[model samples]
Target chain A: MTLRAASTAAADRARIRAGEHTGPTSGLAPGLAQANLVILPADESLDFPRFCVRNPKPCPLLEVTDTGSAHPDCVAADADLRTDLPRYRVFRDGRLVDEPTDIAQFWRSDLVAFLLGCSFTFEWALAAAGLPIAHQAQGVNVPMYVTNRRCISAGRFDGPLVVSMRPFAPDVISHVVDISARFPAMHGAPVHIGDPEEIGIDDLAAPDFGDAVVVGADEVPVFWACGVTPQAVAIQARPSLAIFHAPGHMFITDRHHDDFDTGESHDHP
Target chain B: MTLRAASTAAADRARIRAGEHTGPTSGLAPGLAQANLVILPADESLDFPRFCVRNPKPCPLLEVTDTGSAHPDCVAADADLRTDLPRYRVFRDGRLVDEPTDIAQFWRSDLVAFLLGCSFTFEWALAAAGLPIAHQAQGVNVPMYVTNRRCISAGRFDGPLVVSMRPFAPDVISHVVDISARFPAMHGAPVHIGDPEEIGIDDLAAPDFGDAVVVGADEVPVFWACGVTPQAVAIQARPSLAIFHAPGHMFITDRHHDDFDTGESHDHP
Candidate 1:
């Protein structure tokens, strides 16, 4: 089956909702926007929104569902949050408990779902523009790190900036920055282009999250703010209860990745 | 004294906070970022945020204070919403009733303040680039009109798009689009450059808000999404209570108007 037939975003959502498709969501919805999901209680919603505002590179918010309402009209028009995603990681008091294929058991009337822009949105843009992604080519998860720079604190949510790394040749780094910057809703521009140590990563080989891919002799490492930020911060805060998409198992929006493009006109706003 | 010296932004806020300056804030903060202010009860906050997300050009949100918080940390760290601005227009059930300089009397613990980017932020850039502003040149407010275009509605905040008009010579319309496009946090680019009737405005001589300016023979009238949208929509909803910066009065932010540039790398994203 072609990628399209093998991975239907709507179908996958249905299967996940039915407890059938319990695996990573990457590569499932080829052109659709797959998001990093963060579910938090209503009482602590203020801090999470502030955290995203202060660290937009990682937490470019796409749509914020109303408290106790599972639907985000803007991004995923009709999807149900409690059981639409393939998997969810539950956190209690900032500690991870169990990874569940569905979260209906954990659903609460006071939860607010946030759909954040993910790197995958820009990756598709880059690939279509003929930019090579080394990690994807190597079939490995993108490398991530905990940076030395602290995120601007918002109430109880505060932690080090988390970044995902992708290696590209010198000239290509600029191309990546130029392309990714256009998707401000999806982390916009690269936070740092070169010198990983500058941001406090001691070794690229030992990533804090995901698998590290090779950085070619002529290639430089490019970093974009990661969506894991709000999650990491939320988990750190140990809210009474929180839920997030398992890493790499994102929530798919009805919007095609390209549909998210406001084009040059969007750059104006 | 010239408007430049007399309109020192820092001093204007200082005097306003002290109850000495209680008039329009226009031209008072010269080169600083002045915002359109909207205060709504907490229950209505989500719809307004969605309104901004959908109609970004008219409502490029710069800062949204947490529900009930008087401080907008990103815009003005120490400014108090209750007393900083020169004037406030209070609406009860969507009808304007009181125009007060201080909102301390109406302050509520569940109020949410939204600061939207205003066109004034880009006016300084246009003049610096040698583009003439007909309204400013004539010592009048920018002419605005209600357009036929229906803004992408978010919940109960549905309304027609409102735009401000500026006449520019044919040769300079493209340049204006290019310069203003940089400040997305400010209404970035012209919504319509040449035709007035196309967007449903009947005459250039009459305006929905502010004063009309002369359109030279070689000039074309340009329309941009206006900040008046939120206030107009709010009044229509006639919420139990709403407060906004009176026309020509705005909340001055610490960010220089130029700091919110989004044009740097549009080609890639």
Candidate 2:
């Protein structure tokens, strides 16, 4: 199947819903908001949101669907979560069980869907400022590292913070932080910049997830909280069932990148 | 037996904890943050926070304590919910059954306490700007009304939006909105202004909660989302057990009014 970019989120979702589009949503619906999806049973609902609240940097909550409901109330009123995304990975007991285009077969009355802001929005902000994105340039996944920092635990959810790295010149690093920090709903600002070892990231050449990029001699690698943290933590809890959007496949919403902008420009952890 | 203001929030809570101060927290801990407390059983916990997330104007959730844990993790890490507040109201199936200074006996392992941002923060912001609050001037409660507009529901927790009225000159109404709008965590901006009838407020002389204040001949009434909203809505849910901070007996936190300030000056719903 060929990948295509649609002019609008509605168009993109419609194609994906009808099974005409089954590719990653990276460039589709260019300006509209894209979210990382996490569906869990109602029993685990409270602790999950609490986990997001406690570790906002890693998991900026966009909207949470009502228990057992596949339709979102805030992000997109009419959009159905079960079929809106291009792909979903179903996890059973922390292990990947299946990858499906539609989750209607697995929808349960006790399940709740949580939509979290993705780093894609802030990447637009950085790209708009002419800051080159390494992964995009290299045609590979953004390098992500599991850090030594443990997120504030809420009930059954607790794990090491995961951060994605991007190297930039020292002088432009402040500008990069300034641009990204304006969107808190997205992964805002860097967690560590100068020394990767401080955050337990021993080597930049090898990353736990995604492809690693070479750092220029004059550039320091900057890190931002990744959306993968919640998925990692949630799976670490070993819940009986969990569902996530496949890598690069996200839930598209009508909201745009500017919708997530915060007034504060201060770098957030 | 006497109500007195303290120099700081810690001092005020210390007195309350020791049973030395059992009065309204209005003037005590002047600059510190005061929150509206809501405790619900585990079954109702998921919907309650979802309700707040959906209706943030009236219920900006500051923190949600872990189930059965008296120690708050966010608003005040060491503060004990069972005894820190001056007073608490315990409800059974929506009926008020007990008013107590200490609720250690009622504490259950399944209870989850939610701390919501109170209007007291923005009232300070308004007062700091020399805005004369009508109720403060009249030495009466800030009049509140149940609005015609129902809030967006979040399974099992749905009710009308409640708003508190403050009369201000039309000339400075925009400024008032701008100032309070800077604190989205506090009920940011007015929901309705001018005649109250538009929002189902029929008589200005009578209010659903708090005492009524006379509107001036030259001033218009500005209605802000009130903290009473969550209490009214939560009780309406008829949860088997619910606990709240009694009127004027809020849970004081170490954070101050300035801490709630947002960069946005635009009025929010």
Candidate 3:
């Protein structure tokens, strides 16, 4: 299947829903919002909401669907929840059972879908300022870690705060923080910078989550809240049923990614 | 009971936890964070989390406690969730049943506690910037409303978005937006400014939630997402068990109200 550029998020979602685009959605719709998807049984819904609320740094919420409502009406009008994402993960009793492009076969009315803000939003801010994201340049996954600090738990959702690490020169760290901070809809700002041990990550090369990236000697390791949190915490809680986007396969939204920039309005004013 | 102004939120929480203070906790600990509390059974936890993630404007999550765990490690640092708040409301099957000072007697092992961001944090920001908050001057409850617009539902947690209204002169609305935008931890910025009907609110005099205040002709009716959202949505969902802060009563946290400001760091550099 051929991937198209400048496709509106809605158009891209339709193509993905139709199984025409099985590739990663990076740069597909430059301005559209892309989301991290987490689906869980209704029983754990309340605690999850509390968890996201307490940990907004990593899981800045975009849209939460009605119980069993696969459509995220607020962000993507009339979009199908089960199949719009390029790929998905099925976790049963804390273990991965399947990696499929569509979750329609396992759809449940009792399942709740949470569309969380992803770092893709902030990448727009960085690019707007002409800063290059290293991972994107290398065509590899961004590094992530399970921090020593525990996240505020809610009911069946409790675990350590997870952070995504990005290496940048000292001059760029402040710029990165400023750029990312403007996109609070995405994980906003760095949780830790310069020191890895302070947050209990001893080896930058070995991450608990995503693949690690090389940090230049002059570059400082800057960390932001990671979307992997809900998955990590939820799995630890061992819900009977859970579904999420497969790593690197996100749900693309109708919103232009630029709309995710909270600071754009400031600039206009 | 005597009112005390303690220097630390922990100290204030200790006093409240010991049954020494039973009144509103509006201005007790100047720097400590105060939250809107919502409690529900484990069964509804999943849906509620989705609800909060979807309707972030009305439900800025602060902390979510584990099942049967009254203590949220992030917000209060050992404070009991069931009793730290000045008061609570018990809703059974959607109907409010009781308003009590402490919920320890009613605590269940399956219950989950959620602490949501309150407007108090943003109000502190406005006051710090010399913006006038009329309700603070009148010593009354902030005006809130149930709008015609529906919130994104998660399971049973579906209802109209409830917003707290504040009137600001046209000149100050932009500053209010800018200042409040910095505190995304506290509902961030105004969801709607100027026209209420655009969001489905018809009359300003009639509020679906809190008391109505005067809005002068020279002022624009600015609305921020209210913490009342969880309660209103939960009631609509009609969970078998639900508890929340009784309107104005709130949970005092160790973090101060001003600590929510995400702008100072950005402004300093």
Candidate 4:
């Protein structure tokens, strides 16, 4: 079956909600936007939104669900945050407690859901522009590192930035940059290029998270602020409770890739 | 004296702080950024920030001061919000009670200050590109109107969008758009072009606020989401008390026009 017939975002979400699909959401909804999910209690909600605003590159927020509401009206229609995503990683007091396909039992009226922009949107853009994405090509997770650069502190949320790396040829760097820059809603442009040491990445072969890939001799490593930063930071903050999507297991939305074009005039306030 | 020497943003702010200047900040601090100010009580602070995020084009937030802090660390250093702006308008129970140069007596320990991006930044870009800003040329405030478009509500803050208009030649519309889009932090790009009635403006000559300038026969009236929107919405919400900079009398910042370039990789989170 073709990609569309095999699994549209809505279909994938329906299957996931029914507990039929519990794997990572990558490649399931090819041209649709997938989001990084963060659910926190009302008491801890204020600081986290500020955290997203201060560190926009790592946490480009797509839609912040109303306090205690699971419906993300801005990015998705008629979707339930509690049961929509494929898998969830629940943390209590910053310790991983559960890995569940659905969080219905844990849902509370005080919970606030933050749907952050994921790199998958830009990854599609890169692939369309004919740029190689090493991790996807190799069928492995993108290499992520903990940089020495500290994120601007908001309330109790404070940590170093986490970045994902992809190696690209020197000549195509501009093309890659141009294509990715169009989706500021996604991580936007590369944070660091060429020098891993400058951002405190001690070694490329050993990554903090995900599998490291081969860096071609003529290729330069481009690092973009990863969505993992907020999840990691939220975990570090050790709030009473925090819930997020499993790495690579994103929450798919109704929005298409073209909906995020930066060229479109954002005239409404 | 030259424009730079005659009035630097820092110097203009200092003069305003000492009550030496009380007039509109226009034509002063030519190349620096000026910001619209909003001060709300801590009880109402949470919803306002979310409102800004939901309606970014009209309410591009520059800096959100820490609760009860008069300093906006992101945009200015050594600046006091209570006394820095040329003038401030105070509203109590949604009614304008006072317009003062200094708000020290009105300051509360629970107050939160927000500095929003202003369209003046883009207007300067247009002027530098030799595009005529009719209102500026005629020495009057740009015409502003209420539009049919309703802003996404966040808590109690909800109202129709307010837009400012500028007439540009049809041939240079693309050029004007190109220059303005570079500063998304400022009100970037026009929301509507060539049609005022479509957006609910009954007549271009009769504006809701500010002075209306002549639209040339060959010119197309372009409307941009105005910074006045948030303030108007905030006032309509009728909190216990709200404070904001008077129209045209803005709070000057230390940042130069170039610091807000949209091309930079914003990967802070």
Best by lDDT: 4
RMSD of each: 4.9, 6.1, 4.5, 3.9
Worst lDDT run of 10 residues, candidate 2 chain B, spans B260-269
Which candidate achieves the best DockQ against the true structure? 3
Candidate of highest TM-score? 4
Model 3: per-residue Cα lDDT over A162-243, one tens digit each: 9998888887767788778877778877788878899999998899877888778888888888899877888888888889
Misplaced by over 4 Å in model 1 are: A1-22, A256-269, B1-12, B18-23, B26-31, B43-47, B66-68, B108-110, B128-131, B148-156, B167-181, B189-204, B215-221, B265-269
The digit string of per-residue lDDT tens for model 1 on B158-195 reads 89999999888877777888777766667777788877
List model 2 lDDT by residue over A65-136, tens digit each: 877889876767568999999999999999999999999999999999998889899898889889998889
Kindly indicate the candidate among 1 and 2 with the higher lDDT. 2
- Candidate 2 deviant stretches above 4 angstroms: A1-7, A124-141, A166-182, A187-194, A213-222, A257-259, A262-269, B1-9, B125-140, B167-182, B188-195, B203-205, B213-221, B256-269
After superposition, the stretches of candidate 4 with alpha carbons farther than 4 Å from their true spots are A1-8, A264-269, B1-8, B263-269
- Indicate whether candidate 1 or candidate 2 has the larger TM-score: 2
Give the per-residue lDDT digits (tens) of candidate 4, residues B80-150. Answer: 99999888999998999999889999999999898889988888888888998999888889999999999
Error of 2 at A27 (Å): 3.1
In candidate 2, position B47 carries an lDDT of 82
Clashing pairs in 1: A93-A238, A94-A238, A179-B268, A179-B269, B93-B238, B94-B238
**TM-score of candidate 1's A chain against the true A chain:** 0.93
For all the predictions, what are the DockQ values?
0.23, 0.20, 0.32, 0.26
Candidate 3, superposed: residue stretches over 4 Å from native: A1-7, A40-54, A64-69, A89-98, A104-112, A145-162, A200-217, A232-242, A264-269, B1-7, B44-46, B93-96, B196-217, B236-241, B266-269
The alpha-carbon deviation from the true structure for residue B127 of candidate 2, after best TM-score superposition, in angstroms, is: 4.9
Comparing 2 and 4 on DockQ, the stronger one: 4
Candidate 3 local Cα displacement, residue A250, angstroms: 1.4
